[model samples]
Target: MLVEIPIIQKMVLYFGNPSLTFSIILFSILLSSGLGSLISGNKYVKRFTDNSYYYLLFTAITILIIGFSLNKIIEITNDYVMMQKMVIGFLIILPMGILMGIPFPTGISKLKNIYKEEDILPLMWGANGIFSVIGSLLAVALSIKFGFNSTIYIGAMIYLFLLFYIGVFL
Candidate 1:
């Protein structure tokens, strides 16, 4: 989200104000992720087993590809009206949001299987929340120093690290 927020902000700036861009991007990600989570029930996740790692890899690849192409996307839609650009931005983000949603539920499912303790679920969620806040703050600092593109690349690298962790450690 830290990475995505800036990308969306940059894209939406071509058509709208900063506040509107922020609201739309945030709302789109939340709504899409919520839907993705709802769809990723235990049964859906259980079918994957270790194959979930591949999903994470694919998600990371997708993020990198999208991040690389974001400028082109903005250029392609530069002539679009605000409503059109908003819709395009939502469309562009929805897939990444869905992919982002998968890891949490999948990780929880794995943890549940390993620990056999439902209690740990909340701890995982809390840790995730804390890390996300820290990441967002870090992203802001990074963006200030390196610009949004580099910040996004950093986020992509983090995803790559996640893929490596899942591949080697999990």
Candidate 2:
């Protein structure tokens, strides 16, 4: 999903400075997500944690919003300067990336509390890797066939489904 954003931006947004836009997007996502992960452990931030449910929910909703509205966003801001456009893109991606970051650590903490005797961390890590690989491949294929917007919608649906699954099971 992170990997595909630059491609989609380049292909769809047609920013005047494509390279700069790509760099902005990549940097924004990485930095924002890192901040989110870092804050997840903070004492103040912990008070706001709702077992990671809101994080996943926000992430899903944000992705879906982006999927449905990004092109229109670009259109509305088409007259802005290239730097302004890049900044807008970065700001828009920030929340979604940050929300994306919180869930993993929260889940890990939850699992640790629930399964102290068994070492399920390795299994969770493996599952994370496998699903990430599958998701990356699926994102590429879906973006190729249906374009980036639809691919994002599918990703959001997957996130929502995962949220539902976890809500039911764990």
Q: TM-scores across all candidates?
A: 0.87, 0.79
Candidate 1 TM-score, C-alpha based:
0.87
Worst 10 residues of 1 by lDDT: 44-53
* Residue 119 displacement in candidate 1 (angstroms): 2.3
Worst 10 residues of 2 by lDDT: 2-11
Candidate 1: segments with Cα more than 4 A from true spot:
42-50
lDDT of 2 by residue, 1-170 (tens): 63345244543454666676667777887888888888889886676676556656777888887767777877788898877877887877788778777767877998999999999999999999998787777777877788777777777887788789889998
Under the 3 Å rule for N, CA and C atoms, how many clashes does model 1 have? 0
- Per-candidate clashes, comma-separated: 0, 0
Model 2 spans with C-alpha error above 4 angstroms: 2-12, 16-18, 43-48, 117-123
RMSD of 1: 2.2
lDDT by residue (tens digit), candidate 1, 1-170: 55775686576567568788878888889987876677677676546534756676777787788788889989888998888988988887888888787666767767988889457887888999999889888887888888888888888788788778867896
